[model samples]
Structure formats: structure tokens, C-alpha cells
Target: MEAINISYRAMIILYALITVPVLICFFLKLGNVKQILIAVLRMTVQLAAMGLYLDFLFRFNNVWVNFGWVILMIAIANITVNRNSGLRTARMFLTVMLGLTISAFFVIVIFIFIAIRPEPFYDARYLIPISGMVIGNCMRANTIALERFYASIKKNEREFLTYLLMGATLREAALPYIRESVKSALAPHLATLATLGLVSLPGMMTGQILGGSTPIVAIKYQIGIMIAIFTAITVTTVLNLLLSLKVAFNEYSILKRDIFRN
Candidate 1:
């Protein structure tokens, strides 16, 4: 397969395009100019670093190094999940990490190793990008699940306590929150799936076709990636939210208010 490369000078010019939106925001007084600028700047820097690292990783072709890189991505994602969920690093880090790593690895291995049977199981080319995509999606789902669950419980403390006082077990009392949280996390994906072909072209499928894969082959890969994404999101959200229950509550089965950041 041929590689598609872009020049660094082109990237700089592309980054400058962000200023158009920043100027528009300034004139309209929408108050998002700084935030938008910072976000674009950070995205540029982060993707640039990842691009350089990926170039080295593809060149090395070392199994252990590739595995190490995947683990590092997972760890960073784990931390991001906790932070985004408003959960403290001290309490929920390992559970989120374990849940995301386990769910992502299971799905990726089943798809890439057993199904696609990519030549080297740990090939950086396939393993790194695929695992990154899976972990990245799971991170978003888990964050939403965790945050919404805790936030709902806190916002409805009286109702939650009523359930407990009405002879509901901790698990029973928390089920409503669990259902709502999972729905909130997965609803966007469901909507995307429903309007997929009509609304927007999916990035993965577009990339595959642009890389010279046949339309049929690209469509199949797109279907496979979507299935993996949906499955991983469901598994990670449920598992992480379930695991978080252990640390999110007190002896009386009430969510602790102090767990949230101000």
C-alpha cells in the first residue's frame, strides 16, 4: 500500500485556518473564542506528536515496543476517563483502567487477531491504531456513564434515599441511575448509526476507501469497526459504572458529595 504524507508547512497553514472561527466568535460576542482557540491548538500539538510517534512505531516493528505503546495509550485514556467523569484519581482510576483495558483488548483481539488474522498479532500498523480507536471510543462512553450516574444520584439524593429507605438494596436503588447513565452515554452513537449514511460519511470507512480498498471491502471493515465500537462502549460503560459503585458510596449506601470536584 502507498503511504499518504502531508508536509509540516501545510499543517501550519491548516492550523491558521482556526482563526476564522475565532474572529467570528469575537464579533458575535459568543464568548467561545479563547476556548475554541485553545482546543484547536491543543489538538494540533497532540496529533502532531502522535503522528511522529506513529512513524517511529511503524518503523521499529518490535513486538514489545508496540505493546508498550498500546499500554501507554490505554493508561492515558484511563486517566482522561477519570478526569472527565469528575471522579478522583485516588478512588476510581484503577477500576476505570481495568474495565477499559479489558473490554478494549478483548474486542480488538477478537477482531484483528482471530478474524482479520493480521500477519503479526502485535503489528504496530494494525494493533496500535485499532486499539487506540477502540480505547478512545470506550473512554468517552465510560466518562459519560460515570459522570451522569454520579451526577444524577447527587441531583436526586432525596429520591435515591427514598428507595433505600423503602427496602431497596443498593443495587436496586442504583439501577435507575445505571439505566439513565447508560442511555445518555450510548444515545448519541445510536442516533449516529440511525442517520449514518444520510448525515455524514464515517471517517474509518472513508480512510479505507482512500487507502485503495474496494468499496465493498471498505464497507465491511466499516461495519466491523462499528460493531466493535458499540460492543466496547456498552461493555466498558456497564463495567466501569458497576465497579465505581464500590468507591462512590458510603456505609449507608449514599453517594458521597465530596467525591465531586468544585
Candidate 2:
């Protein structure tokens, strides 16, 4: 069965719903209506372009092409993570790129080959979406982990130095920061995992159901995807931090002031 398509007129009506918030912002002097409208327009344009590319991906469905796309995605996510983490991209680029690529590729290979096992094994429909979900979550986790971690160390230079001066190795001294970063980065995901079915209807399951998949099937797929997402985020966050340690610190174990960009 085919999912019902939203008409252009229906989309216009849906877009009209934003007018309420825009007007509210306008009256309250929130000064973001222009930004809001621009963001909405950008979202429309971006999604339209993505839809076009996705159509091509589905049509071609070549194994190498699919993997090349995933690699491109990994590169983009790496760049985005570093850019938003307030870290100088040049300093941490290779570490972030390699860390995320390894984690994402490892998880996706296991997930698709051992778990999902779609036809042809490299089906774009399966590989692309799953890779996106994994890479996207990993990106967010890395951003939070890196930003919180470096900011914490930078703010606690005295304590970090004290740890170092008191006979702690660089690894030992960074342990506390690493623990804090990993915990904080994964916290929201832990909460979401706990509250998932009872409090939330996940998008994957909802979309599957809307696409005429059985509720049971949708739930099963959602469970697999959630596990993959959780694993990918956790592994990528830790790997990024560990791999970045060498680049982020000096020979004296000092956190480099130049690593972070204001």
C-alpha cells in the first residue's frame, strides 16, 4: 500500500501554521521573525535538494556509489562536529574524521550484515538511511563531548595542572574530563532510550507505519535502529575524545589554548 501524499495546497496550509508563531514573535519584539522565515525557507530548499539526491541514490543503487556517499556523509559530519564544537578544525580534523568514520562504518557493517541483511547487502535504501541516522547522532554526540570536555578543562586549568603535577599521567589526568564528557554527551540518549516507547513515538516507527508496514514490523525495525544509533553515538564519542587527546594537548600535557576558537 502506498502512503498518502500531501498536496501542495495541504503543504501551504501546513506552512500557514508558522504564521502564528511569526506574528507572536513580531509582537513580542523577539527580533527573530526574519531568521525564522529564512530558516523555514532554507529547510524547504535543503530538503527539496536532499529529496532529489535521494531519488538518484535510490535509482542508481550502486554499491560503490552508496559507500562513496556514506564516506562523503562521514566527512561532512566530521567537519560539522568540529566547527560547532568550538574547536579549531585544522587541529582536530583528521582525528574527528577518522574516529567517526571508524565507529560509523563498524556499526553500520555489523547492523546491516548481521542484523538487517537486506537484499544485495549494500542496498542504498537500507545503507544510506541507516548510515545517516548513525552518523547524524554521532555528530551531535561528538559536538557535545568535545565542547563540554575542552571547555571544562580550559575552565579548570589549575585543577588539571594540579593533577598533572601530583604525579598523574596525561591519560590519568584527563580521565575525569573524559568521564564527564562521555556521560554528559550520552545523557540525553540514555533518557530517550529509557522513555522511548512509553513516552514517545519514534519517527522511524511512525514513518514505517505510515508507509503501511505492520506496527510490529515497525517496532522491530525501530528497536534495531535505536540500538545502532546508541552504539554508534557511544563509540564515536569515546573514540573522538581518545583520538583527539594527542592533538588537543601539548607535550607537557597542557590543553592547548589555540585548539579552541572563540
Taking all chains together, each candidate's TM-score versus the true structure is 0.91, 0.97
Q: List the residue pairs that clash in candidate 2.
A: none
Backbone clash pairs for candidate 1 read none
Model 2's number of clashes is 0
lDDT of each: 0.86, 0.93
72: Cα error in model 1, Å = 1.8
After best superposition, candidate 2 residue 153: deviation in angstroms? 0.9
Give the distance in Å from residue 35's predicted Cα in candidate 2 to where it truly belongs.
Answer: 0.9
Best by lDDT: 2
Compose the digit string of candidate 1's lDDT tens values, residues 1-262: 6437769899788878878888999999999988998888798799989989999999997999988888898889888887888878777878887888888988988888987887788888888888888888988888889889998898999999999999998989999999999999999889877777789787788898878888898888788888898899998998888888888899889897767765
113-199, model 2: which lDDT tens digit per residue? 788899989999999998999999999999999999999999999999999999999989999999999999999999989999889
